[model samples]
Target: MPKSLVNYRVRHAFLVSYLLIVCTAAVLGASQLQTDPGSITVRFIIFGVIALILMVVGAIMGAVSKKRSASDIGEWNYRKSLLSIREYEKVLGRHEEDFKVFYDDTSSAGGCCCTISAAYLLYLALGIIPEGGIDASFWFTPAATLFIIIGYALLGLTSYGIGQHSVTFGVGDFFVAPDYRGLKHAKMLEDEEALYVKSLVKIGTQDDLQALFETEWRVYLDGQPDTVYIQLKVDKAHIYDYPYLVGIIVNGPDVVERTENLDIDTRFPGIVEYMSDEGVSVLVSRFDIPSDSAELEHEPNITAQEFRKLAKALARRLIKLSTE
Candidate 1:
């Protein structure tokens, strides 16, 4: 399924159905007025004008306000955007100005009021004083009853649509701005991945591998809050068999690094591939040292405390390497 890059939203069903109900009421009232020659009165005009004003106000509300929260993952997939921390911050900063809020998800109170008032007005307009005077036969008429029911249902639906955040813009979903940052992250990730692969391939000696490690750390340390942090994990149960420690990716181009770096040469002497000694019952038997790249920003198993510990350890290692 194609995804939306912009924040344009509309409620066409609510708008179109609302207009239809108003038109139908008008047409039916006009027919009744024509049938009863002396029934066209000032009260009828007032009701018509008021209903028109309410409809217009509803239309404006739907047009200007956003229907969903900015953080809605289904509508705005921030994770898939693969934006750097800095770029993600920019997107969040612009959210308030970009999407104006009028009614929230719990606006059902207003909807209830609207539904009640519409139903009552519909009953009065189509029943008791349809024009200026009422006919005995039309007082308990089925036509008025039908119109009231239909009008109530239509108004209820329109109000519900306005009050909730489920309505989507359908075709207008793709009408986002060309320069949306989310749309550009894929290209940026691609370029970064290329650079990462090149760096990995260039390690020929232990000194070169150390240089790559320092370079990657230096790049992240320089970027500070904007850096994309990656976490590599080893199941606690299999940690002993894995040889190398579960660690963070100090440097990688994209958010995920899938490439294998298991070549145990002079440049990566201790990087071994191990088979779990846990017999045939083990689900994952083979393990790569410095494991395949971490898939997410942080592995779920590593807690905040564990992260701080690992970070301090890495900092010590970096300092030692720098002094050497």
Candidate 2:
């Protein structure tokens, strides 16, 4: 079958299963109600309606929840919006603002409570509110309703928080900025926009890379915070010549270098190939290192292994400098 057909079938199956379970629970609750002499018809009707509404809403929310992207700016905006709503609620109570606090609170809670409440109510409607007694069933209804309300309220607040964090522009946001340094020179050659790649490079003679490694040991150290640094070099040869010298520098001074027996030349070819496959453009010479301060301004995405090696190198350098 086609991929789309498979996906449709999967979704259809899920929907059918969900509906079956819900209908079964409803039937069971109704049966229990029929047997119970003291059951109020009006109460069951009200609970059933509420439960149905919660389930529909919760399911819809759940389906859409994956589309929500969490970002720093979005989170900040949501918090601000929620706080504004809360402040308005405090000032006006139920009637103070055009936006209702109950609605706000409900949306903030998210879909979990709505789902749970609906399921609980469906069970109650089926009269399976658990035969432990009235006390057990009585608490269940209110608890389920409360959970639904709280869940939706959280969801609304979180959604709003995320919205607030998105990048906003008024007047000064520019698509292109002038490069005071030679950073933009690399991009100009390829007729492409500027893209940055960051990795640390060890400075010294060929033997310095090996010396740096011997000074640093590979061990999990505590009470030390992990730090990531992005280094830019104008020279590509510096990268090729050092082998895993950059990795050694980042690992820290105490890390032992095992370059003698290992082939660093071939191992990094895979990384280069991977980057090339990923469409990453490179434009740097052999060995010239860029200024640290200038490189620090631009954040570049680095691979996990690259980051670890760079971090270890920095730690080693820090240790050596401190001792000196």
Candidate 3:
């Protein structure tokens, strides 16, 4: 599963908006107390305004998430894209493995909860000494009530959003996995844990990766936020071409097909757009078995040094596309 970065980010954005509303409301309430002190209208009007603004911002972010990618976020450029990979047992009870955890922000919930609690305490203190106050609890009672009402509201919204995103990311992993199970090829793509991390690429935090057919796909992301992993649904039946060596920009699905050809939906944003804009193409041939077993050779006609040189060329291309 790809990191639920998009949903997490949306949830995080919603949390920030909630915070803004809380802080703004708290400050306004304090100001009102200093002036007239008895007025309760400030909570409604100012908060209403803030809510409106947040709604507008949310709409814009929705558009961005739907149309653009997560890499556009300035903070994401230098950070690692994905945090960890989880097995189905670690996540939902999926039967397969190969999905990864992309993004999560449950950590932020603790911060929000603490902030709400502190704000309530602060308001309670100020209200305890309010004018015309008689009973001690009576003075602080309004403050506590106000803060709890607002605080719980904010905290609840944030928590729900966070959970919703977590569930969304978890489920999406399975959606693509069915298309990919038992489809990966090439021994070089495996990581130390043999998890095959590089096969997945992320375009941005907005959209999730669509699972195409299983094939040999190489991923090249170095955890820079500016880099968004573009995802495309690979067809169940198609050939593909990928970079292997420097000068050998195009390689064979030769183990199977007569010619290497990569067919990606260039009309879309993520990988296809990035590849088209950069003139990069990944080629794969049909996975047909060669009748002559002896002729089914997979080695390239190049020396070790030459192979390294060829790989460097593709590496440079990958780096450029990755950053772009």
Candidate 4:
């Protein structure tokens, strides 16, 4: 596992602050040189304008960083070997009660306070926050105070957002392994892991349990809050009526193939969406648990272990059908 999420947040705070200061200084100097280029009295006017733009841009980048990418994929696959689904499933089991032990829900707010405090100190050093009351003339005091308050708040919030993003980007490191034991049922997409993981859902059956012992369809999750998905590594176009077949198998032989693409029905059986990347077709299906949590839960009627058994069976059947 990687360092505690807090460590990443702390590092992110310092990194962001340092860059902000350096970039702001550089931009302010360039702007000054290009414009009046002389009197360096207060410079608060230029500093405020440059700082606002930089912080806004930084916040936007922080938001984008939350979206996962091929490069962000984790050390396990960062030139590392792949492990089977069974092995990962075993890892899942080991951490069943404490899987979150490796995760910190509060890490998102990490560095928020530090960022705010640092901003305060930075303002003091710049004479923006003087020992006496307002640092500016009577006419400019209100505007300056308001701008400073808003800017300071943005700094804190941006830091928090960035820390949260780091956690999102790096959380997968705690859940890495590669194999396709559960691919046929859904399609995988590039950067699909960018989607937040609300919870892990498994929906296999029992009779095909033994078959899973041999099949090789990789399993992964995607989508976000309120929607769960499974991604598999295969050219789904090769499979005829892929969505219809899965719906029938999981929903029942009575399931109908609609004139349009399949959808998650009132029962939430599952829906299939498709995409292709680099010639590899990927499928997205809705076999995910419908909750915003890391803990796994089944239909109120079934036990958790029973739910895993069902998921395994579903995987086996889907793989067998794909081979045929």
Candidate 5:
């Protein structure tokens, strides 16, 4: 719940409590002359207890408000974005200002309420809160001890759930930014934008490549009208097993004349060679990596040293595949 709403509800409770106490006091004083002293004492004790309970509840609400300070929420959202791709800006080409993200995972209903109930049971078994001790809380402080235990447990659960699944942006997710295409097609793709503003989220800094060319390279790649290029970037994600950028080329300069799954190198991965428009041949993965290096980025188009000469290597392949 929002902090504002919580505070509003607490304030309303306090206001109602005060009104009820005032009205009860006036009615009791008016009837004092007709009632016995014993009954009057009982009524006084009851109203006093009610006011005390309301005060304690108010104090709890105040502490909760402080714990969820505005700064805490802002910091939490920033840190949470890094774990997953939910914050699309790091991957998609969208105007940073226009994007908005949302998160929703409610705790199981009565989650902490149940915990408190269990604590009551345990206290009864150990004789801390007597067997008929439910109302004994008014006379003792053990009830507050149980409340403290439940509160900490609830906070821990909330933190744990947030940590486990940091993001939900999946494989095909994308954002449309004019800057992505140098603002040329921003107007063209405007109608294709999401209904709501995207949220900015935390993205990992472990590899600069992901930030440079996100998994949505497909969006950038497919957007080009005539250019086919070479891409040597890490797997489309931060959580993936592979840690290195793998070289892959698009729009071969030559159509593949034929294709055969061949082991080009015993130590290196294999290839599926095939050909199309403008001498375009789709040359991609064919061999499975050995288990030991299974996590290595699969670069079927180019070898180690050749990767450093990426542009020239791609041009050469485009030529060889085209004219041959």
Candidate 6:
């Protein structure tokens, strides 16, 4: 049989055993009450209620196990193994805080489940003792209680094992933050707010390159706090009317001399209005070249050498901005 089916069967069997034991105990207790006219009716009532509770709990747990199994199978069928690591990293990055919460919650749940299940198993075992036989027997009650506690501890560990595997396979918990701090930090030149420039070489189609740019920008933007100002200086690269390389300079709120795009000069007012509506102090300018040719000479294509230079410049700028 398949692994999922096997797991389902095992869980079902455990629950069935638990329910059967409780039901059998209830039946035996009820029988004893009928025979002995002096028997305590309260004892029978208490046992019956306890048994019913266990049966219900077991049934609910069984349902949850089955549902989890089905989800695992579906994910197994749909998921690709090659990208598993990348996906895991992506999840960690995007939902760092959420993952922490999930880990803590599941661990606590596992511990409680183990402890409670053990206690119930002990209760069932102790029920086997005749009421009048040995009222003060220390051996059976203590031993049974110990065994139940240990058994549930082991069961909880098993549950955790199942959860870990399920999460790894993209089956169990999928909780994570929508925007991860890692991506933001990756693009960051320094810890403080300041201006930074980064350039991307685009050898592919404009659409493909643009997609990459958007992905990077979105991740960075999402990581920032709402109070920060973000500005983007865009340098468009064109090859036969098709845009290629795009250089970007990101500046924070303190930057002076507002940059303008010649191509869409008229659109700036609308863009500013949109940003205001969205509660973001950010703007993306079109490719702009000044009449003075000295600026072009200074801001040349960003090579590996240029990147190092920019990193240092960004660091210095951040220091100045923070101190100010």
lDDT of 1 at 254: 21
State every prediction's TM-score relative to the real structure.
Answer: 0.28, 0.23, 0.26, 0.27, 0.31, 0.26
lDDT of 5 by residue, 1-324 (tens): 233212345445544554454345434433441343234353233323332333334334433433332222221111323212234533443323222221222244246445544643443333323245434333234343343333333333333333222332221223222123211212222233221112223332221212222222211122323233232223323332221222233444544346444434334444444455453454432234445444656533333332223223333444354344
In candidate 6, what are the lDDT values of residues 1-324, reduced to their tens digit? 234223556556655665465555545544543454233343334333444354344545544554444323222112212112244345344333323423233335446556555655554444434464324243324443343334333433344333432332233444222223323332443232333322221111121111111112211222333233233232233311111111222343333434432222221121111122222223332222343555454533333333223333333333343333
lDDT of 4 by residue, 67-99 (tens): 322133222212222344444455345443332
Candidate 4 Cα misplacement greater than 4 A, ranges: 4-48, 56-147, 155-324
**What would the TM-score be for candidate 2 when compared with the true structure?**
0.23
Question: Candidate 5 vs. truth: CA RMSD?
Answer: 15.0
Candidate 3 TM-score over all chains jointly = 0.26
Model 4 C-alpha RMSD vs. true structure (Å) is 15.6
Residue-level lDDT tens digits of model 3 in 1-324 = 334323456646655665565566556644553453343443333234433343334334433432222322222211122312333122222323323333333356456546644644444434444445334343234564465346434543444343343232332232343324322322223332212233332322223333222322333334423232212123322232222321111221112112322232222111111122233334221223333445535522223333223233334444453443
Estimate, for each residue in 1-324, the C-alpha lDDT of model 1 and write its tens digit.
Answer: 111323333445545656666666556554554454334353344244534454445544443343432223233221123334354345433442333232123335566556656764764465436446456355334554455345434553454445344334333422232222222222232223211110111111121111100011111222223222222222333332221122222232222222223322222222212122222111111233344335324333333333333333433333332332
By TM-score, the best candidate is 5
The CA lDDT of each predicted structure is: 0.35, 0.31, 0.34, 0.38, 0.33, 0.34
* Cα displacement (Å) at residue 227, model 6: 22
Cα RMSD, each candidate: 16.8, 21.4, 18.8, 15.6, 15.0, 19.5
lDDT by residue (1-324, candidate 2, tens digit) is 112112344444544554554454445444443454345553354345534443554355334331232111111111111112223323233222321211222243446445455545544444324355344355345454443344333333333333222222111221112121222222222221121222111211121111000011122222332221222222223222121222112332332322222212221222211011122221111111233435543333233344334334433443342233
Per model, state how many residue pairs clash. Answer: 0, 60, 28, 15, 12, 3
